[model samples]
Target: MTTIPEIARAAGVSTATVDRVLNRRTPVRESTSRRVLDAAFSLGYVTSSDVERLSESEPLTLAFLLPRGTNPYLALVNHRAHAFVERNRRDARVKSYFIDGFDPDELARSIRHFARRADGVIFMAIDHPKVRAATDEIVASGKQAITFISDISTSRRHAYVGIDNFAAGRTAALILGRFNGGREGRVALIAASRIYRAHMEREVGFLGLVEERFPGLSVSATREGHDDRDENYQHTRRLLDKHPDIIGLYNVGGSSDGIGRALRESGRAQDITFVGHGLTRDTRAMLADGTMDAVITQDPDALFEAAVLAATKGTPPVVTAELYLSENMPPE
Candidate 1:
């Protein structure tokens, strides 16, 4: 069994500091508190009194408003969130709501509803004025409104728990440009929607990098796939037909499968360099088969854990995007 003293020693802090972090009885430096919590988590440290106190008090209700789709990444997020809630059942209650389609009004309604009931709400925000207003209202109501995956910059969300999307885009551009070997051809950009701040930022970064580093490569006007496989397929087909000279492709959202399918069917899978986001079963297969060259991904578990910590501890840890290739793909 891990004790307070063990955790204090592991964190290189005094036992009193560990106690204060665990009990929340005193204000400890953020760095020290993080160290204590990290040590406790690493050691599986727990106290009988803490469990009893939590079981006696009202559980913190956390609401996760995720996008509804067949997107494997989002499905993984939903699954892991439920698992997290079950693991912390004694301390918190987590409810996940999937918003169908891209209806800002519907998403706003869901946000408003949860704001009234949940102690904290984390959502994949649509960058819209109405959604931003609802998020602002939720924050004003003293509830924690944290945005994940995508964020609404104009909103008053407490914090964003995800990777730096702009940097992810730049990284993708760097890989795609290098793989093409300074080939003078157009690069097609696909995304779910420009209304998603994350996608927009990625597009901005990709274009900026291509302009600065790969002057020989030009980017096509981004096509919105709405995160739908069929939509992405159609868009990709249209792009390939209109611009037969396109040598590279980058998908800033879900639907890597669609993009891969289009390339495979057109017999261009081996010719075009493909880069995308997320490392799911489909993307892993694509990588193995040479349809996708690289994937920019962030850990869903890390993202959810950060959001939960932000809700309970008032500080969300930063997550960085990692580039995955066939050789470096994560184990299933």
Candidate 2:
């Protein structure tokens, strides 16, 4: 393995400069940083990531990016995340920046702004190329990148803190298959967008598992609801109108209320069994009302802790997930 000293010598910089660039302690001129990075890359000199303690010396800041979720289920995540940050603030060892929603250009601007301000960033945005590129620039600017919920495409983010989406998809298929008593029927999948890696992988995993395990169940159609209630309503209505045989629906994103409404309006509520994602207030109510069968869930508190740990400590996270049903929930 090529040593930092060797790279420093080759790049015509001191070993201290190489160390500073690697640890992101101080900003070097862009040309010097590039030369050192290129030399390290060429020599395959990967930096060690042993967690260095905070030293009780310098304070830190972490930036967070997440889509604005008005739905009670997801709102809980945001609220709890903010509280968690506050708890960490008493020592003045941590600070936070929250980006409300996702707009490619706005998020990009936010990333650029935070790159200079934060020691680390925890991103929950979609996996768009532009988002990834902006995150990469943040990394290049020396901030540790921690991605939560969805993995971005172009950035070499430091850690991922959420459920293994493929496994979640497989779990969904298993639950749905058992719900149907192994009797296959047409299934409809509605997602927020293809830009979210977790959502896309869940759909892929669901289809893969169903095809491999329960070959009789067929997918009727897939639609992008963009995680909007009105859009979900319209898409659900269209899908039901076009495919009256659809026996199951999986909502892998926000706001299943619209879909529930569409099914009720179509007089097909009893005809279809719905399995959705998350444990939002509305979804929990739907499960209670028997509008939805079950929900695949990740604990919001655990997710927030894991995200913060990964942001500050730069370690891989293990997600603890659960399958929720009406019988399993606490009485309201």
Q: How do the predictions measure up, each by TM-score?
A: 0.83, 0.78
Model 2 clashing residue pairs (backbone): 73-280
Q: Name the weakest run of 10 consecutive residues (lDDT summed) in model 1.
A: 48-57
- Best by the TM-score measure: 1
Q: Where does candidate 2 stray beyond 4 Å? A: 1-59, 69-71, 88-103, 330-332
lDDT of 2 at 69: 47
lDDT to native, each model: 0.87, 0.76
* Alpha carbon RMSD to native, model 1: 8.7
The local distance difference test score of model 2 is 0.76
Instruction: Go through the candidates in order and give the clash count of each.
Output: 0, 1
Q: Summing lDDT over every window of 10 consecutive residues in candidate 2, give the lowest-scoring window.
A: 48-57
